[model samples]
Target chain A: MIDAHAMLGDETYLRLDADELLRRMDAAGVDLAVARPMGAGMVVDHRAGNDLVLKAGPRIRGLATVNPWWGPKALDELARCRDLGAVGLFLDPARQGFFPTEPVATPVLARAAEYGWPVMMKTGAYVYADILALAEVARDFPGTTFVAGFGGFADQWFELPMAMRNAPNLMLDASMMWGAGIQQIVDRHGAGRVLFGSAEPRNRYAVVLKAIERRGLDESSRRAVLHDNAARVFKLEGGRP
Target chain B: MRIIDFHAHLDERWLHKPIPDASHMVAAMDRLGVAQTCVYTMMGFYAETPRNNDLLLERSQRHPDRLIPFVTVDPKEGPAAVDELERCLERPEFRGIKFHPWLQAFAPSMLEETMVAILKVAARTDTPVLFHDGTPPYSTTFQIADLARWVPEAKVFLGHAGLADYVDPAARLLRDVPNLYGCYCGSRPGDLVHLIETAGADKITFGSDFDPGSWELLAERLDNTIEAGLSPEDLEAVLWRNAERTLRPSSR
Candidate 1:
């Protein structure tokens, strides 16, 4: 299985390198994992983290973060990330402290859309990262595939369901979400819009994998969630069961 | 290895809708090889104490070998709460108490008179008290630690190991508070290994916090923990031994 969301490099709170990430993926039976620089890593030096992920080899897919505050420099970094084998883009509105619809973020997103790269945004938390704001961005960038992390969390319980129903361009990762919520999302949005994400080292891969398995999806739907959806959306190569 | 789940909930009143009943829970236990499960009712969160406790009692009685009931008390119900506790504790099947500070809208600090009264009874009864920890203000690690410190005699289990954010602080509290134990519910596999390393396996227990329809998730989480690099002895302690010792102190 491919884990749609994961992080690598040192953070203010934790340090997770490629070796540890690979170890966890192996333990969890994940064939490949997509990772991005964490909040602190992004703030300090996203390029360094992205470079490390690139060097971690093919089993690990890297998503580069471009700070919207960097303006033209942000697009430059996105290009660099693409050269470094990053499959997509990762944005954290809550950590980077910018709204998704801001002019600065719009250009970065638009650049991603121009490349047909999926943009994975941290959502479910309050303020700038809420699902409503994410929906707004998804609506504007219909061509771009937007993945919401944490599946909208506990606080946005009601809002996430509504957001999922309305926003077709928006997909959700099953990280830190309950089994029931994952089932509801599958029932409402179908398996194609749901991706398996572990948020590993922060959350357990088994927890999210189990949530998907517990949904009682038919074999095809299970494959769609476990790897196919993420492989298709992120355009990951060699991510087949 | 034998499995004893320290956290499982009953009642159809969950916000998620269509909660599982006792039969569903038993089927899950049978399938997963969960020899025993400590259960409480979700209804208790919304002040349905008597009705909820009655359902738990009936279910536990019906599936005496599989279901181990943990009587949930609102405490804010004052005398009624104490009476219910006395009533439940009188039964051999009721193993412990489950407190949801966030759900019940009470602080775990035990500053409230009713909380103190409940803790006192718990101490006298020598029953373990599982406090819902993780959320802030009302149910944070420090607040649960305050309750643990206040009632040193009562065996306190911090549910979720103070969640993802407060594992370090929870680890510190576990070292300082002799009565305080960490139960792995909704905790990451890495954190579970960290707790075992930092606080020792003796002070940690395993709990699925399993909702009615999420049995496969529970089994997978257990597998995750096993694969996360615990020794067989440590795995046994976490999966059942620690919980068995805590719930039945005589077993230790």
Candidate 2:
């Protein structure tokens, strides 16, 4: 199994290093997980956090996060992280205090697109980061693959499946969403673009794993969601990282 | 172990899909080993108050042993809203009041006069009020805290416990305000643990927010609560004891 999203770093809120993450992954039967930096790395210094994530072993791959407010410097940081073996781009508009569709973030997004990387945008909270805004950003960047993290959970869940219906380039990582929502998206939209994301340390692996497990999907579809799609999106193919 | 879901939804149609009858809810409850659920209607919360409240009360009566009814009144309706709460509480089947300010489109601070009037009625009848919080502009934690502080006599529950964000403020309010209680619904597992550790488990209640026919979601939420690894005593309190106390008039 592959978890599309999980954090690594020791900070104020979330505390998880690569070894601890690998131990939890072993316990949960997860083969590979895409790692992002938490806390200060998420909000402040992108290079410092990206450096930490790039240091993970083969079982873990890194996703780079850059604060768009950093402007041209942010693009430089994204390029630097890409050189450091960061697989994809992760942006938290809510935490970073910028909207996904805002002009300030578009240059960085364009840079990621040029790198042929998928961008994971945190959704479900903060008006700037909800699925609707994600849909808008996806429309602007037709070439780039945009993954909606948490997939409009808690509040925007009611409109998520329909929003995904309209945005074809948009994919989703099921982190904090409910089972029925995931089931509906897969049953209607197909599971080709859907990936299983545990959002671990912030959430429990078992609980999120249970959501996909109980979605009543057949084995192939389940594998597509849990491992195949994420591997394809993060480009974690050809043996180890 | 007994589980009493403090938050769940009963609606004619959820996201334009028809929800099955109360039997569907009971069946899900049976599958998840949940004993009872405090049922609220989304119809009343989104649109049409009185009729939906009546339907919620009636449907819950079908399986009174498993489902408890909580009615919603849009405080945007002003005096008529207060009248509806009074009208619903006249029937013993209705145990609490639910408000979805984000959906109903009214801020508690903005609707202070109307909200206090409704809360006064809840205070008199000793009924708990559950608000759909954690969203900004209308349903943030600070707004709920202010409302809770305004009507100290009335018991309030922060439904969703700050959801994806705002859990810190939710935990703070839960700790500081005497009547403010937290519901472990819609938040991540780590956030739930943080709330319990910071605010204490005595006042927190477990909720699924499972719309009718969502058996998988019901089961998933229960799994999250268990995986949170609360002590047996704390788990018991969160699972049922807190809800049982909130359901009874004198306990709060």
Candidate 3:
């Protein structure tokens, strides 16, 4: 199964290097983990962290984070990271301190669309990246797939079903969500729009995996969530790991 | 290892989500090696306390060995709350009480009089009270601690042990409040290990906070705690012994 949301390398909160990430993934029975740099890596030095993910090999899928405030430079890095075999782009409106729908972020989303890459946005608890903000951006970029991280959390959970129902381009990552919450999303938007993500090291991958497993989806929907949906969205090859 | 899940729920009405019934819960318990589970109906916290209590009682009676019923009482119901508590506690299957201040929309601290009233009944009947303790404002650790202080005669279990962010405060309260015990459900492995070390294994119990569909998540948390270096003796205490001692004092 592809973990659509994961992070590697040291951060302010937790330190999970690529090797340790792979080791933990093996322990948790996760085949491939899609990772990106978090916190300072996104706000301070994006390349150093993205480079670590890129160099870690195919078992780890890398998503480059670019500060949209960088304007043209951010757009250039978006293409450069994709050229370096990055699966998609990662944006953090909260950590980077920009509204997702701002003109500055527009260029980044436009560039990602141009690269044919899906954009995964951090969307829990942050005012700039809340469910409404994410919905607006997803509506703005029809061609780009926007994965909502943390399934919008409990505080914003009530708003998620409506946001998800309204935006076809928006998908939800099942990290840190309760079993009932995951089932609600699947029932509202179908299993194709839900992807399994483990905000690992901070949250247990096994917990999220179990949340997905408990949803009692049909075999086809379960496969779609655990692997097929991510593979189709991120264009992941080599089937299930 | 033999397991007794301290926290489990019957209804999904709180989230307006559907969950499996008591039969599915027993099936999960059998597969996961959980010998028994203490269950409360989610519908109780919403409203209709007596009805939900009866539902839980009936469900537990059906699977006496696999399920232990915990009645939910809204102290705000005043004298009616006392009646409900007395009625439910009369049953041999009803072992404890469950309170969700946050979901029930009452300030846990402001309900001290009501809490003490409920605790008075609990102490008299030898039933433990498990309060949903986490975050702040309504269900904060300090708020639950205050209730425990008011009714020192009653056995109090802090649900979720203040979750991840409030573990330190929960541990601090656990240190001073002799009657206040900790239930490790939906807590971080590191936090659980630290709590075990700080509060002593006798004061900590295992709780799954088992949502019908998430048994694997509950098992994973248990696995994490085992990996965090809980000793065999300590594991047995947290897994079942402590719960039995607190909820079923005569069982020993």
By DockQ, the best candidate is 2
Ranking by TM-score: 2, 1, 3
User: Using lDDT as the measure, what is the rank order of every candidate, best first?
Assistant: 2, 1, 3
**Best to worst by DockQ, what's the order?**
2, 1, 3
The 0-to-1 C-alpha lDDT of every candidate, in the order given, reads: 0.80, 0.86, 0.79
List of clashing residue pairs for candidate 3: none
**Per-prediction DockQ scores?**
0.37, 0.72, 0.15
B151-249: candidate 1 lDDT, tens digit per residue: 688898898786745677888788889999988876566677777777888888888878667777577557656756789999899999988887833
For model 2 chain B, where is the 10-residue window of minimal lDDT? B243-252
Summarize candidate 3's per-residue lDDT along A1-241 as a digit string, tens digits.
Answer: 8888887766543567788888888888888888888757777687787787777877898988889888888877777788789988888787788888788888888888888888888776546767789899899889889888776653566788899888899998876566677888888889898888877765676667765666678999998988999999988875473
RMSD to the native, candidate 2?
2.3
For this target, which candidate reaches the highest lDDT against the unseen true structure? Answer: 2
Q: For model 1, give the TM-score of chain B.
A: 0.93
Query: Clash number for model 1?
Result: 0
Best of the two (1, 2) by lDDT? 2
Q: What is candidate 1's CA lDDT for residue A8? A: 82
Cα lDDT of model 2 by residue, A1-241, tens digit: 8888999875545588888889998888888889898889788977788988887888788999999998888888888888888899999898899888788988989999999999998888867877899988898888888999888876787777777788888987888777877887898789987888888888888998888777778888987888788888888873221
